[model samples]
Target: MPGTPYFSPRLILGAAAMFGMLLALGIHILGQRFGLDLGDLWGTPNGIIPATAAIAWWLIAAVAFVGGYVTASLLFSAASGHLPRRLQHALIAGGLLLLIAAGQAASGPSPVPTLHGFYNGIVALMLGAAMAFAGAHFALARH
Candidate 1:
């Protein structure tokens, strides 16, 4: 399978992250429907600050970690390549993801209206990127 063209790193990472995000959103909706107190990771009505922000942050972190872990694990395990090369690809993917997150934080509309919400969002984004990096690191270590 030397010549088998696997997807580029960007595609793999992006797809995994988006898929994870969607799954998290679904979970959030289900939690709401069931009257479960899952944090308001998604914005609340009237810009109200809910008590579940911490829980939401952790949820997002888990999503990001899973995304990175899956992507790296699959790519590193299936592709017949050097370990260092595979790791470099993973790093590049992580960096790209971080860039995208930063850009969104900078230019996208605020999810909440308050400064606390803004700072919390920023911290969540940073935690996401860090968790992703850690996940990829662990995945690579296993290989």
Candidate 2:
């Protein structure tokens, strides 16, 4: 690895963020193509999310988990000297997922919370975070 150009961990994190966002979008689009109907429950009456919608959210959370896993793995491999171990990787991956979510929240107006209700966003966030944390924790596990 001598003579190889060195890159900052921040730069790697930024790239991971972009990669995670794109991965999330691609997964979402693929889900839609498969008739998942991600927005089907956007404005349901009485803030009720049916079984199908719950299933859809599960898929979304799965995608989020993959995104977080890939991004964190990429960063860990790219900057092994920076990240200490499993706990740090999990934390970093979770943070990267949150960064992706924050970027998504900032990109445009999301009517999900306003129209669908706050629980939708909360559920998505919690599921996504939990899965992402688990994914990252296992990504570098010795098995």
- List the candidate 2 regions with Cα displacement exceeding 4 Å: 78-143
State the lDDT of candidate 2 residue by residue for 1-143, as single tens digits: 56535666455544544554444444443444445545667667788766766667778677766776676676666565554578667866775675566466545654444544345444555555666655555554521
Q: What residue pairs are clashing in model 1?
A: none
TM-score of each: 0.45, 0.47
RMSD of 2: 9.2
Q: What lDDT does candidate 1 reach at residue 107?
A: 57
Report residue 39 deviation for candidate 2 (angstroms): 1.6
Q: How much does candidate 1 score in TM-score?
A: 0.45
Among all windows of 10 consecutive residues in model 2, the one with the lowest summed lDDT is 24-33
Which stretches in model 1 have alpha-carbon errors above 4 Å? 1-51, 81-111
